[model samples]
Target: MPPDPHADELRSPPEPFSSRRPTWDDVGRVADLLAAAERTRTGVVATRAEDVRVRWLMLDGLEDVVLVEEPGPEPVLVGVGEYSTELDLLDEATVVHVEGQVHPAATGRGIATHLLDLAETRARSAAAEEGAETAIVRTTVIDGDDRARAWFSTRGFVPVRHLLTMRLSLDEPPRPPTWPEGITTRRFRPGRDEVRAWTAHSAAFADVPTHFPLTLEEWVEDRILRDPAFDPSLTQLACDPDGEVVGLAFCRAGVEGAPEEGWVRDLGVVPAWRGRGLGMALLLDALGTFRTRGLTGAALDVDDVTIGPAVRLYERAGLRIVRRIDVVERLTSTG
Candidate 1:
């Protein structure tokens, strides 16, 4: 029989690596891989095993994570992909945030592309499961990561937002916060303050881009009550003369990589209380609390859009932009 010219094309090519769902035992290795990739791309080692653990906990399960490795007796993790979904409070759209990382040594290969494809597939499936009328898939890269930006751009993603990580050195005492007239501050009470604090937070961030409202149960369980590092002394609430919560500062004593640096996880003032110095006061109080706790620095992330109020407020409180992450998204479905 004569050989057909297209026979070679019909044969499948061998895959270069193996992929599997990440297990809890893989947390440390996954963190190491992520840190290595970040260090190579951004010159920073910010990811820790604890961070990976927290993120995994937030996801439905480890099933949302995929790890690719070179096949061998000692397989090396060469790529990773993960996705999580949140429902937009206003429009009820499903926003799936996808993240992919390839080892620096594995660049120029198809590993990243494969991981991203898997992420998108997972996102679409999640959106379908949620019965979403609109599905958006989003990802982020460091501001200066042109290679990554180009990769995403080629894949139909467009830049949607920029987030800045601001840092403040607490080498000296922070200026005392002057209380706004008719406003007073107090420490956060875990059981007593959850509802009011959540209300204030939801109202304050309702206008912010990409902000989503969490149910009071979710707010208490996932954010404050379940967080092992939740320090009541570090968290504060601003109250009106009637003792209603109008603003809040939810802070963490230490984050994953920087033990001595406090993280201002969330700080906001309700719409009615804006421009009353309540936001600034809560920020200053957070910084003061961090300093009093022997923390050498404080950090927080805010939107970097033009003249953003949060950015301006943070800058006014002596926080300077240290890093920027560019968020990109693609509309996958308009069902």
Candidate 2:
């Protein structure tokens, strides 16, 4: 058989690294870039392929939101950035969330700046279309990453919130959960529990900082149903004797990179149920679920700056502060 003439073109080196819109084909390359960046900082590839894929699919503008840098023949991705304008779902304000990762080796080349510029332009344009009263661009930085924090600070981003990422080792069995009087727990009922769980979560975070109520549709689409990692068996809900959902511990199991870790994506107790141990019981139940699934540990995040006791509650439940993250925002509009 003769070698195909097009075979060389297929194996040919790629063009010089440049920024361009991403496609489904870029998911793997983008995941690699994110994983490499994660390993440099945390010694782990926390950003899994599923995370990238699901996030890309969930964002408001799939095509305009993503940018990647392909460097060399092998087409190794060195940078990723996404601009999202879905904050209108949280409020009428035009707020865009800008998130991205840059390869550690690719720093100081103006890549980050260029990405931010592109994101801001996209965000502002989206905001204008929405006729928003105000436009804001937001991003987060790990508290310990001085370089990242400085980079954003130099670009006029102001820190607005401090989030604590907590972790608990399951090597030691968690204390027996003591449910409050008249409260009972069970795994979520797939179709029936969606709205109920959403209600419980919204009520739980209502008093927290920057509280934005998510509509039932938004709640189901973004946080619950769309995630491939969501596990109803691991999601514990506390209900009253009459069957009212008073608390919840929504778990996300089988995260791509951290297979042995279960994420307590949302753990909360309704206002009336606070201080009755409902939250603690719900959290312990989630941990037990993880343990039953043979996970090594569990993790969750809280806005410690705003909800001090929420952090205390997790600490008392045996979770320690593994890291800190800063939420920063910049106004894209002059007025």
Clashes of each: 0, 1
Judging by TM-score against the true structure, name the best candidate.
1
User: TM-scores of the models, in the given order?
Assistant: 0.81, 0.76
Lowest-sum lDDT 10-residue window in model 2:
5-14
Candidate 1 residue lDDT tens string, 123-238? 67668888765578889998657899998999899987787888999999999999899998889886788889888888988887667668999878877767898888888999
lDDT per residue for candidate 2 within 210-307, as digits (tens), equals 67778999888977667787778888888988888989887887554467888887877889989888888888888887888899999887875445
- What value does the lDDT take at residue 52 in candidate 1? 87
Model 1 Cα shift for residue 106 (angstroms): 1.6
Pull out the clashing pairs in model 2. Answer: 14-73
